[model samples]
Target chain A: MEALVASAVAVMTAVGVYLILRRQTFPVVLGMAMLSYAVNVFLFATGRLVVNMPPVLSDTATGYTDPLPQALVLTAIVISFAMTAVVVLLALGSFIASGNDGIDLGEDRE
Target chain B: MNHWIIAPVVLPALLAPLLVLLARNDLRAQRMLSGAGTVGFAVLAAVLLVQASAGGIGVYRLGDWPAPFGIVLVADRLATLMLALTAALALAVLVHVISTGWDARGRHFHALYQFQLMGLAGAFLTGDAFNLFVFFEVLLIASYGLMIHGGGRARLRAGVQYVVMNLAGSVLFLFALGTIYAVTGTLNMADLALKAAAVPAAEAGLLRVGGVLLLMVFAIKAALVPLQFWLPATYASAPGPVAALFAILTKVGVYAILRMVTLVFGAGSPAGDIAGALLLPAAGVTLMLGMIGVLGARDLGRMAAFAVIGSVGTLMLGVAIFTPAATGAALFYLIHSTLVAGAMFLVADLVRGQRGGLLLAPGPRMANHGMLAALFFVVAIGVAGMPPLPGFLGKLLILDAARSAPTAWAIWAAILVGSLLAVAGLARAGAAIFWATNDDASPVPSQPLALAGVAGLLVALAALTVAAGPVSGWLNATAEALYAPAPYIAAVLGGGAP
Candidate 1:
């Protein structure tokens, strides 16, 4: 399970980096969404992967998974969602105004 | 009461729901929200100041769970001071937003602004590493909306770049956090501080890698050079109040550096050892490059943005040197920079609005009233680190501290050169804006209320500078506590973990 998640993270990171390096906007946004998910999982994993155990105490379970990572990831997930929304808004807004979502407006002299 | 513990967060959170409910029905509801937000700022500022004055740093736990487990808020003197600064600036900008009567402050605008404040306040207050990222996103989202509020082509274009850069940093930040967590199994800052200090020498290099990566993420946001290109473009083109709000965001990034360095990654830790060495050169080079940008920049707003980059470099100069006096100077500079940067951006907005375009645009009619131009000049002087201003005094502290280092002579030279370049840049821009009577003059007197507010802000900043002696003493004590580690460690850990 850890290996699978690691491989997924690797692929996602590669794709995201490639997209980020591009000049256009939409691909970058797509890349960001992918990267954020990868990051969330990666961060969650660092609390050290656990299975069949949740952070919340159930009295039935002998011990719970680390509560710290659970808290961290949950907050990261929400914030990433917010970040992605803002990026999309920016992309659409840019597309509407200048008709290009390229990296920069080529020096912003105006 | 504990009720006050959540007022900063609660007020803003409550507004979002109320705003949704009022989406279609009442414009008055939106206006009321702006007012409510100002009140929230006032209350939050008062709370932070009173707490700081008492030399008490309060921690609050949700569901009453203690720290290193439940989410924790540690309002140390530094945190409270920062929170107060954020609140005061937000309140001033909020008032400017309401009284100025721009077309953008509609149903969505006020709520977003409120959320942005909540994010900032949260970032200022939260003591844990994980929650800091959460707050960053909240502010970033609201910032995107605020930046493109008017639907201008250029603003949208600039805003996209801004979003992309911050997103990149956000990704890096999380990855860094994961690596740190993987190594230590700790996300709480206080916990990390204790654990990070105790990491064995064999894994020291591995740990430092994660630590430096974390600093890189923050440096990008603070607009340290090479990473800073996105800022001037985005900030210069952003709407007035939005730019004003952003003034605090980068400082938050700087605050993260301070928070991390002095507590979580101090000396004897691998991260601290490596980061200290690297930050020094970065500080010097960043200052040089930033000065060049300021000199070459054409637009008033963008020049101000570059100047901001230089100011960051100055603050880092002291910190990178890493003595108590040096770090204290850095803290002073951080506080001073936030105010001066906010004021500079507000002046840009005032200039742009009056002239109906960029300040340096050819044959542009300067519509700013004479008194307004003088006000802008005063703020510009503050940013330039002119005497009797907090900016100058902050730099004085930094130079005084940095002068004692082995690298003292070089640091001293870099600071002096940076200050000169900053003054020259602002002076050049000021001459073009105020002295060079435009071919077409359109000096618009600001609305009375807005003028009054700007005047009040200027006066307050000046007062702060004039009262610098006592404030410096207060800041020194705060800086002492920040450096000593024992008080902070004892408070959070109950001193049990050795």
Candidate 2:
């Protein structure tokens, strides 16, 4: 399970990095979204990936999984969602104003 | 148990939403509320500063939970001093924006400004690592709104770059946090400090990787050399008051570096030593590159932006030394640089308004050229670390502290030469703006309130100079507190072994 999670994160990060290097704004935004997903997964996996276990204690069970990583991941997911929304609007605004999807500035064109 | 430690964060947080809902369309009311709130904040910060300097470390835990399990806000001398500086800077920038009517240019300016203040205060006061990241996003998103507040092509372009770069840095922050948490099973700074030294030898590699990644995140935020490509464009393009407020943003990076390094990885730790060794050379290069950027700048705003980057480099140089005296000097320099950089940005706006542009070429004579020229000269001298100002004293302290370090000579040469180059670059810009003859253009009228804001900041700089003796003593004590994490650790973890 850990191996699977690790490989998934690696693949997502690789693709995200590749897309982020693209010149188009939409792709870069997509890239960031992908990267954030990778990060969230990585954070989630920090609790050692226990299966068939509750995240709470009820005084009946011998043990339970660490719930902190789950909480952290949830917070990260919400923040990254907000980040993506903001970036999308910004990129869209920039595209509409300049009539181009390229991220380069006017001076850089010259 | 003190509630005041949380007020700096809570007041702004509550006021921001109220401004958005209650005073959305009422600009006058919005300004009044924000101004009042900021003044209140400043007063609170001053009180906190007094309390902290008197050797009180206030730790407020949310829901009255124990330290390692709950969100906490720690206000020692260092945090309160930073809080005070942030409040003071926010007040000045608020006045400037109100005076210049810069807030009218964008939607939700008051709300965003208040939120930005909340984020800064929260970041400075929060004792939990994850909460710091949350506050970072709060400040960052607000800054993105403010950066393009005026809505121009240049701002849009720069704003996109700035947002994307910081987003990447945020991801890095998450990864670092994950690594640290996985290795140590805790995120509370004091708890981490206790656990950091006990990390098993087998996990040392992971800890070092996490430490380095965290440093890189801060390095990006501080705009150190390779990671600084976005700063010049962003700062130069942002609205005047927004740029001015951002003067403290980079210091947030430096503040985090100092806090984390001193608490979690103090001197004598292998990770601490490695981070310091890495930071010194990078700081030197950042200083050199920033000076070159200053010299090569084509406009006053861009020059000011580069000078800010250079100042960060200088602050980091002192930080790299990792001595109490050096850290104290860095703290002093940190305060001075934030003021001078903010003043420079405001001055850039004044100059830009007068000449109708910030370009380096000779322009028409300003209406009040003499007064503006004097302001420029004094601010320039301060920024370049010349005499009769706090900047000079801060630099002397840093240089004096560095004399005992192994790279003392290199640090000395870089700072001295950097100051000289800054002077030359600023002088050239000053001469072109104020001295050169151009008869075709009419003088631009100055805004009284805006001028007052700039003058107010200059007065604060002067106050910093006059109060240097007591201020340095406080900072020295703060530095001592930072190096001796026993008090901090005990306060956070209920008097456990440090």
Candidate 3:
């Protein structure tokens, strides 16, 4: 399970970096969204990939998973979601205004 | 728990929404509310400064929760000093935005400005790593709105690049935080300090990776070399007052480095001042490249942007030394650079207003050409680290502080050459804008009130220069407290060992 989760994160991050290096706004935005998802999953796995255990510590239970990562992941998800929305809107605005999806400023680009 | 510890953050958090909801359609009301809120904020920061200077760390725990368990807002000398600087810069930026009617060119300028302040203040005050990330996003999102305020095609395109670059940096930040948390099991900075200091040899590699990744994120923000590609375009295209306010943004990254190095990753930590080894060389290159860019820029706005990058490079050199005296000197330079950079941007904007654009070519003789030239001259001296300004004093202090470092000679050479390039750049731009003029066109009339904001910041810089002794004395104490994090940890965690 741990290997699977780690490989998933690695693959997503690789894909994200590749897409982000592209010059177009749509691909860049999509890359950021993909990266955020990979980070979210990686953050959740910081608790050591526990399953079927309570998040909170209790005397009755045999053990509990670390709950802090769960909370941290939740906040990270919301922020990344909001940030993705903003980037999408900005990408759309740039496209409509300039009539091109290229991200670079005009002077240096060939 | 002094309530004032949270007031800097709370004041803007409350006022921003009020401006958005109540003063949405009322520009005058937005102006009045934002102006008044900022004034109140300045007063609050001053009060916090006094409270902090009394020589004990103040920790305000949310919901009465204990440290390492819940969020805490810390008011230490370093945090409070940053708060004061933010308040002063915000006030000056507000004056410029309102007096020049720059806010009227866009929707929700006032609300966004307040949100930006809230984010900056919160970022300075928070004691947890994850909370810092949240505040970073807050400030970054607000800055995106402000960046394209008076949107043009170029500005919007620049904004997209800026946003995308920072998003990548943010992802890196999260990954670093996750790695650190997975190893240390704590995100509270003070607790992280304790855990990091004692991490077993087996886990040290992961911790070091996390630390280096974190440093890279900060390096991106600080505009250090190889990661500085986003700054010039974004700053040049951002609205004048917004660009001026952004003078504090790079300092935020520097502040985080100082905090992390001294408090969490000091000599005892397994990572052991990870930024220390990397910052010095990167800073030297960053300085030279930035100054070269300044010399090569074709417009006043882009020139000022490069100057900002160069100043950050110099500031990071001071941080890389990690000695208490060097840290104190870095603080001095931090204040000087923030004020002077803001002044440069403002001067650029004023020149643009009179000359019809920021381009360097001669045009109409502007009204009060002599006065504008004088303002630019002082800013030029400050940027170039020439005598008689606080910039020179700040650089002298840093050089003096680096006397014992192994790479002192290289650092000095970088700064001196960088200063020369900056001076040449500013001199050429000044001559082209103010001295080289077309006599055929009538002199453009610039509002005297617009000069008020620029003059106010210059006055502040003058005041900083005059009060250098007392100010450095205070920063020395701040640096002392930073290097000795035991008191800070005790204050937050209520005096207990891990």
Candidate 4:
């Protein structure tokens, strides 16, 4: 199971990086979303793989997965969404203002 | 749980909507209300400092839940110090903005400014890693609005780039935080410190990999060299108070790195020498590169931005070296840099107003007033780490700590070269603007507003530097607490020996 999860992570990271390198704003935005999800899932797995146990506290079970990771990942997910929304707006705003939405928004520093 | 830990987080957020409603009719009423709210925040910050001191680690669980299960707002000495500084800077900006009459009550500016303060306070006081991200976004949102205020073309262009760059950084930041979560299974910084340190040897490398990724993202924000390109341009073009405000934002990134490094990856932890070595070189390079930039820049705004960069380099040098004195230097320099950079930005705004900014094409009213030019000259010298200033004292501590190291000579050389070059550059700018024969003075309007604020800040800086003994004593305590992470970890982890 650990091997399977790790493999999935590797694939996701590769795809995300490739998309991030693309020369268009929309693809880059999509890449960020994919990358954020893969990251959150991967981080949740770092506490070590656990099965049939959720992070929620219950009376019967001795313990579930680590709750700290859960709390953090949840917040990361929410903030990432906010970030995604902002980036999309910026890309749209750039397009409306400049009539071009290339991938290199401000990569060159002068 | 003392509410002090969390009130600053919620107050502006809750009060902003209220302000939008209350001040809709009366502009004077809005200014009064906003000023009162800011004062209230500063007072609450004081209470939180006291609570943090007594409780040792004030963790107020949001929604009445226990640690690692609910949202947490933690305030230790470190967090309290950051909170206190943030509050103080905001208050100072408030004074400057009001006295200068930079803006009237039109255009929802006061509300957004209030929200920005709240976000900064939240970022400082929040305990959980994810909450930190939330606060960062909160701050960024407010910042976007603040940057484009008054609708100047240059401001609009820079604001667009600034937002996009930070948005990208935010994405990477979340990804890094997520990576940490995947490995540690805990987001609470305290819990992660303990758990991450205890990971099995087989898995430690991967965990360290994640940690380094997170560190890199912060390094970018902290404007560590090789990742510090966006800073000067964006900061140079920003509005006066907004640029001053950004001085603290970079430190927030640096503070997060210092805290994360000391608490999450310090000695006796799974994170090893490789991590320390990785960061140490970046510090030296950042210092050198910043000096080079300062040497080459022609414009006043851009030059001040490089000075801010140079200050950050000094800070990174202290933290990366990882000694008691070095860490203390880092902490002290952090405070000094934020204040000095802030004051310099204010100076830039004033100088630019008279000369009409840094375009080579001369404005009709090209620096008719000598007062502001002289004032900025002294400030530029002070910020260059020249004699009898806070920056000089801060650099001395860094050099003292680095004296015995192999890289000591290089850092010393960089510090000297950087300061001297900046002095030459800014003095040239001063000579051209202030001392040159006035062929076409045009009688520039008096820039009394920013000049007064800069003058006050410079005097305060002089006092701090001159009285370095007692100030250094207080700073030494801050330094000791920062480098030695055992106590901090012990407090949050509930009595286990770190």
Candidate 5:
């Protein structure tokens, strides 16, 4: 389970970086989404992999997984979701305004 | 559990939505509410400053939960000082926006402005690392709205770049937090401090990577070299008052570095030496390159943008030395630079308004050209660190404090040469805009209140200069407190020293 999660994160991160390096705004937005997904998974695993265990202190529970990372992961997901929406809207705004979605705008506009 | 520690964050959070809902279409109502709210916010900041100055770290835990468990907002001297600075700058920018009617150019300017202040205050006041990230996002989102408020193609394009870059930085921040939380098993800053100090040598490398990653995140915010490519475009394209308010944004980065260094990685921590060792050289190079950019800039906005980067470089150099006296000097300079950079941006906007653009080329003699010229002169002198302004005194203090560092000569040389380049840049711009004017073009009338807004900032700078003695004394105490973090740790963690 740990290997599966870690490898998934690594592959997603690599693909995200590649897309982020592209010239257009759409790929960059997609890249950001991919990166956020990878980070969400990575943040979730920060508490270590524990399965079938209660996150809270229960009398009958044999053990517990760290609940804090679950909480942190939720916050990360919401924030990244909001940020991705913002970036996508921004990309769309720029694309409509300028008729181009190239990431680089070259030099300062006078 | 003093409640006032949370007021800075709460006041703006509540007021922002009210402005949007109640005063949506009424500019006068929005202005009155925002102006009064900002004045009230400044008063709250002053109260907090006084409270912090009384030498107790006020920690406000959320939901009445205990330390290292629930999130906390801790107001120390450094945080309050930043709060006070933000309030002052916000008040000035608000006045400028109102007088010049920049807010009407876009929707919900008042709401966005309030949220920006909330985020800044929260970021300064939060003691939990993850909470800091949340505040950072809040501020960044507000800034994105404000950035392209008076939307244009260029601005939207710049805003896109800015948003994308910050999203990447946010990702880096999460990665760093994940690594640190994995190692220390805690995200509370005070707990991280204790855990960081006791991390085994085998895991020290991981901790160090986390520290460096965090540094890079802050560095991106600070516009430190190599990562500074986004600033010129973003700041230059932002609306004037928004740019002025953004003067505090970079300082937010510097403030985080100070907190991270002194509180979390101080003295015997595994990542203790990372900031000082890496920040110094980067700051030096940043200073030189920034000033060179200033010299090459053809427009006032970009010039001011580069000047801001240069100021941050100088401020960080003082911080990178890692001594109490140096930190004190840096704090003094931090206040000075934030005010002056804000004034410079406002002045740039005024020049753009009167001369029909911000391009540093000959134009017709503007209305009140003499006064505008004089205002430009004062701001230029301040930016170039000339005598009689706070910038000169701040730089002097930084240089004096840095004399004991092993790389004192390099520090001195970078600052001196950077000042020279800044002077040349400002002088060139001033001459082109104010001196070499054409008589063929009609004079544009300058707005009195807008000019007064710029002067208000200068007056604040003058106040900083006049109160330098008392301010430096206070900052010295603040620095001393930072270097000795036991009281802070004890205050946050609820009993005896860690």
Candidate 6:
């Protein structure tokens, strides 16, 4: 299970980096979204991937999963969602103002 | 468990939402409320500084939960000093924005400004790493709104770049946090400090990786070389008051580096040494590159932006040395640079308003050319680390502290040469804007209150100079407290020593 999760994070991060390197705004935003997902999963896996265990502690349990990472991941998700929304709006504004979505400033490119 | 420790974070947090909900359409009311909140925040910061000066740590835990399990805000000498600086800067920037009517350019300016304060205060005070990340986002998103507040094409372009780059940095922040948590099983800094010393030899590699990644995140925020590409465009294009407020933002990065590196990973640790190794050379290069940028700049605004990057390098050079004397000097330099940088940005705006733009080419003399020239000259001398100003004293302290460093000569040469280059750049800009002759005869009218705001900052710098004896004493104690983190840990954990 740990191996699977690790490999998934690696693949997502690789794809995200590739897309982020592209010159267009849309691709870069998508790339950020992908990278954020990868980060979220990686944060979640920090608790070491326990299965069939409750996050809560009680008097009569064999063991329980660490609940802190779950909480951390949830917070990260909301923050990333807000971040993505803002970036999209910024990209749209830039596109409307300059009529191009390339990452470089128009004059600086030349 | 003193509750006032949380006031800096809570006051602004509550006021921001109230401004948005209650005074959304009423600019005058919004201003009154924000002004009141900022004044109250300043008072609270003063009280905190006084309390901290008496020498004890104040830790406030949420919901009566114990240290390692709950959210906590720690107020020590360092946090209080930063809080005081932020409040003072916010008040100055507020007056400038109100006087110049910069807030009227957009909706929700007051709300966003207050939110930005909340974020900065929280980032400074929070004891948990995850909470720090949350506040980082708060400050950053508000900054995005503030950066493009006036909404020009140039601003929008710069805002996009700033947003994208910071988002990347945030992702890296999460990765670093994950690695640290995975290795240590805790995120509360005091708890981590205790655990760090006990980490198994086998897990040392992971800890070093996490530490390096964290340093990189901070370096990006501080705009260190190679990672600083976004700063010139962003700061140059941001509205003047917004840019002034942002002078504190990079310091947030430096503040985090000082706090985390000293407390959680101090000397004798591989992670600390590795971070130091990375910071020193990078800071030297950043200093040289920032000077080059300053010389190459064609506009007053961009030159000030590059100078900010240069000051960050100087601050980090002190941090990289990581000695008590050096950190103390860095703290002093930190305060001086933030105020001076804010003043420089405002001066840029003043020149823009008077001369119709900030471009370097000769034009008609400004209406208040003589007064503005004097102001510019004083501020330029302060920024270039000339005599009789706090800037010179701060730089001298840093240079004095660096003598014992292994690479003292290199650091000294970089800083001395950087100061000379900066003086030349500012001199050139001053000449271009003030002394050169042009055909146009009309002088731009100046606003009195905005001028007062700039003068207020200048007065603050002067105050710093006059009080250098007491202030340096305070900074030295703060550095002592930081280097001896056992008291901080004990205070947070409710146990030994403190």
Instruction: Give the lDDT of residue B52 in candidate 6.
Output: 85
User: Residue-wise lDDT of candidate 6 within B217-316, one digit each (tens)?
Assistant: 9889999987999999999999988998999999999999999999777776645478678899999999888887788899999999999999998889
**B1-498 in candidate 1: lDDT tens per residue?**
144555677788778667767653666667777677667676776876787579765767666666677667777788888878887787777767777765344447777777888888788888778788778777777787787777678877887888888889989998988888887777788889888888877776767878888889888878776677788888888887678778888888788888888877777675556667778878887887777778878888888778788888888888887678887778887878887787777777777777776656444555445776788778878887887778888989998987778888878888889878887887788777777664756756556576654665677678778888888888888878878877676666562221
lDDT (CA) for every model shown?
0.77, 0.89, 0.91, 0.73, 0.91, 0.90
Q: What is the lDDT of residue B288 in candidate 6?
A: 84
Against the true structure, candidate 4 has what lDDT?
Answer: 0.73
**Model 3, global lDDT:** 0.91
TM-score for chain B of each model, two decimals: 0.94, 0.98, 0.98, 0.92, 0.98, 0.98
Better of 1 and 6 by lDDT: 6
Candidate 3 global TM-score: 0.98
**Candidate 4 to truth, TM:** 0.88
Model 4's CAPRI class is acceptable
- The best candidate by lDDT is 5
Most DockQ-accurate candidate: 5
Candidate 6 error regions (>4 Å): A106-110, B270-272, B495-498
Least well predicted 10-residue stretch by lDDT in candidate 5 chain B: B489-498
Worst 10 residues of 2 chain B by lDDT: B265-274
**Candidate 3: lDDT of A39?**
97
Candidate rank order under lDDT: 5, 3, 6, 2, 1, 4
Task: Give lDDT tens digits, candidate 5, residues B300-418.
Answer: 99999999999999999999998999999999989989988999899888878887788888887787788889998998999898978988988999999999999999999999999
Instruction: Write one digit per residue (lDDT tens) for candidate 5, span A2-97.
Output: 999999999999999999999999999999999999999999999999889999999999999999999999999999999888888989999899
lDDT of 3 at B338: 96
CA displacement after TM-score superposition, residue A89 of candidate 5 (Å): 0.9
The DockQ values of the predictions, listed in order, are 0.73, 0.66, 0.69, 0.32, 0.81, 0.65
The TM-score that candidate 6 achieves is 0.98
